[model samples]
Target: MSENKNYQHPDVQKAENDELEIDWMEILRKIIAIRKTLYKAAGVGMVLGIIIALSIPKQYTVTVTLSPEMNGDKASGGLASLASSFLGGGTSSNNDALNVTLAPDIVSSTPFVLDLFDTRVQTLDGKLDTTLVSYLDEQKQPWWGYVKAAPSLAIGAIKSLLTEEADSTAALNPFQLTEKEATKVKGLRQAITANVEKKTAMTTITVTLQDPKVAAIVADSVVAKLQQYIVDYRIKKAKEDCAYLEELYKERQQEYYDAQSKYAHYFDTNRNIAFQSIRAEQERLQNDMSLAYQVYSQVAQQLQVARAKIQEEKPVFAVVEPATIPLYPSGISRKIILIGIIFLTICITGGWKLFGYSYWLKIKKMI
Candidate 1:
């Protein structure tokens, strides 16, 4: 074995030993050499961080939690089913049209977002009172946002010059939106979000805005709107059925009144006549009037049941946690931001000094 090891080339053995070695002393020397540059980078990063943190507007967040009632099998022995049996109509199947899982998509929809524009909003300090759209439009942004938007603003200005400007007061069409309306929709979409917990079926709605009072108000409004939408969707079929029954009831009532009037008139006019033919005519009219009355009464009963069905089908939402105005802003503190920026700057500078500089020199020589 010793002879075979000696047979290995000396250069090959040295190369294997070098691959296993780590030069910690050399690494320490490199870090110490760039210590001054790292300090300067950290100081610059701290100043930039402070400026950025101060420029950003403080945001307030409001959260609302809801427990929506789930739809169950109502096809069994309800008043609606009884009425359907009497009317020879089929029983209603289980209605699971709107699931809690879909709350996020519904809230993010364009129409739902547009509906919130007219909601009234006020600043916490009572300095501003306006529609949500006006409030959102007048919001202040960080200085950097303006710098980034400068190119887009210029492009929009040129487009306005080339094309006819859209009327601000025109009615909004969901399918086709004006540039200003589209911007508002985009802003609202970002500011509001809905999430549902799969295990608990608990829906949480969150709204973030510059003003605390406005955020709370919007959060409440969103809850009310979502509940209303769910209620409307669930009971739509019941309402339609009730409306059709109402029309049928009206026609059946009119027919019954006509038949009774004819029967009464014939009996009064032929009171003294003892003829068999006149008696038969009177009996026929009476039978017609009785049948009409029976039909009308059944329809009236069905109509009542249909009306009740609408209320039965309506969904209820229990608010587990109501919206409240936040006492403090909900974002990273300025101190944390400053520390993070400084640490990141130091790491990047030190890395460049140790590795990137040498690699760059090698590339320059190759070029």
Candidate 2:
């Protein structure tokens, strides 16, 4: 009796079965019906991909790696310690100011980027030999870019006609950059990059440009400048100390010479004088000369120590990988672009046909 109650009507059972079962054949039929549209989409995608690939310029990337000496002070031990004892145990704290983490910001700074404007660059093909600024000003661009920029260029031209012409020959002030210079600075910043690894303190500088040789040259320049910057910062105080000590040494040396001359003259003039007063005066001059000589000698030693400290405080940088011209262009190739476009086209077309069209039909019927 329970089985008979659960059986219900045959029509109701058939409707429930239809709700639970998927119509795989119907989905396939719908996909096949739109196969022609999918083919047209793929064809259009291929054409567009080719055009984009041809319009984009090839870029070469050059990279340089450096290992900076991170130890606080190389001269803190050995002879430096002895010098410190004599110099009142004054050690330089400038080492703490050496922060490799700021390398990225340093590279992107307006001053640093603008300084590269006059840097001479030669292309691999020997067709271009000009400063970075000139090369950038005359750089090639996609055809569509010019089309898109026409309006802006026209507006700028009109503005320039109405405004007073600025002096192009004037020196650039980092604190205040002109509109054109600022734009160039922004482009250069994007072209050059510096990264430092925290755990190893390894610095990597990269320069990307259309010209491989120029990229390599710029990368090398960046490495050299960065190393110099770090070295200068690390030994700044030491250099100042050395310069001060040199001046003090000169003063003490002059006093010693003057005291020695007086002592010699007094001794020679009173050589035959037998008066007790004369003997006392000669002794006093001798004591003065001795004191001056002692002071001068101590200053001379300190000056030498300071000079050594300059050498000691200087940080050493080991170039792990020097900049080299890149052979292959970076970024996606034309083949990859074509394949990607075709793949995306098929996915979109298939998704729309399978779900989007059906949803649209339902909405239209409801409306």
Candidate 3:
């Protein structure tokens, strides 16, 4: 492998058993000899890609931001959850357990995401929002219909071949549809969907619509919904922790009362203050009082912390950036489509060359 030398290493002679490979020099020759054909193929590919890009539809993408809350009570849920772990519970380590990073997992299973998918957003403050409905309306008319019931899952495997619509024609989408419409909204939830990164909690939720605006609306709604979910989860967990500790505090108080009662009775019955057992009993009672007070004090403080945390922890998701409708078409990549076309053209040309070779052999036999 010397820089000055162009010779193949002799040491790897066995590995150099000649094998067919792509000939770059021959490729250049082919390009030069059949310049018109290759040029035509490339031009056709470009034109085809451009047409494909323009004809069907253009897609828009919007990115929303999710940031960790920075309040002092940032991870109350994690703290309570960890304490529960100390008490032998699973600890339920939140993806946002420490409010460490914006957890994609926590946000992914977000009730808000489900809510957005479920909630029908027809208008933005009374203006008709045409985004979701546009996708449903394919051509001149609304493609949606009132379905009596969802079709069987098995129907999909044979769908392209099966010409018939499976569902009853009477169903409608629940959001914009009437009570009767609710029954017809098949798999609408799938349109509005989210993906959460497994180990790292970055989320990407998407909603497909004929209109770019609707896609943005759905994405924003999903983020808002996720925020509410995190807040609710933290509050519920805090309350649980506080409730458990309250019970423990009450128990400690009862123990303190019982000890006080025993001490009172012993001192009252023992008229002789010089009794050694009486003195020992009094000392024990004092020790018990001290321990009980401290236990009661600690529990009270924990209850306060938990309650304050619940009140103060407000989860927020700041959309650092949001998706905007792409001005130009952002469909399947042009390069990919072009590469496919080139490959197919090569195969066709090869077939023609083989046909010519065979014809030449046939003529030679005749001669």
Work out the TM-score per prediction. Answer: 0.89, 0.87, 0.45
lDDT of 3 by residue, 1-367 (tens): 5874876676555345432233555555665777677567667766765565445444545456444455443333555444433443332223435342444444443233324434444432345644343334431212122132235334543674676644644434324543322322333344455554545445555655545565567677666666676677667776787789889888887887887787777778775779788788788877887787777766766665665556654555555566554344345666666677666776666545545667878999999
lDDT, candidate 3, at 362: 93
- Candidates arranged by lDDT, highest first: 1, 2, 3
Alpha-carbon lDDT of model 3: 0.55
In model 2, the Cα lDDT at residue 242 comes to 85
The most accurate candidate by TM-score is 1
- Which ten contiguous residues of candidate 1 have the minimum total lDDT? 88-97
- Cα error, residue 74 of model 1, in Å, equals 2.0
RMSD of each: 3.4, 3.3, 12.3
Q: Give per-residue CA lDDT, model 2, range 1-367, as digits (tens).
A: 8779777698998987786565766777887898999899899889988887888888899989988877664445735556767765455444365588888998898878888888899999999899898889767778898999889789889989999988878888999987778878988898999899999999899899998999998898888888787788777887998899899999999999999999898888779989999988988988999999999988887887787777776777899999999999987887898899888988888898899878999999999
TM-score ranking, best first: 1, 2, 3
Q: Which stretches of candidate 2 lie over 4 Å from their true place?
A: 1-22, 73-94, 357-367
Report the backbone clash tally of model 1. 0
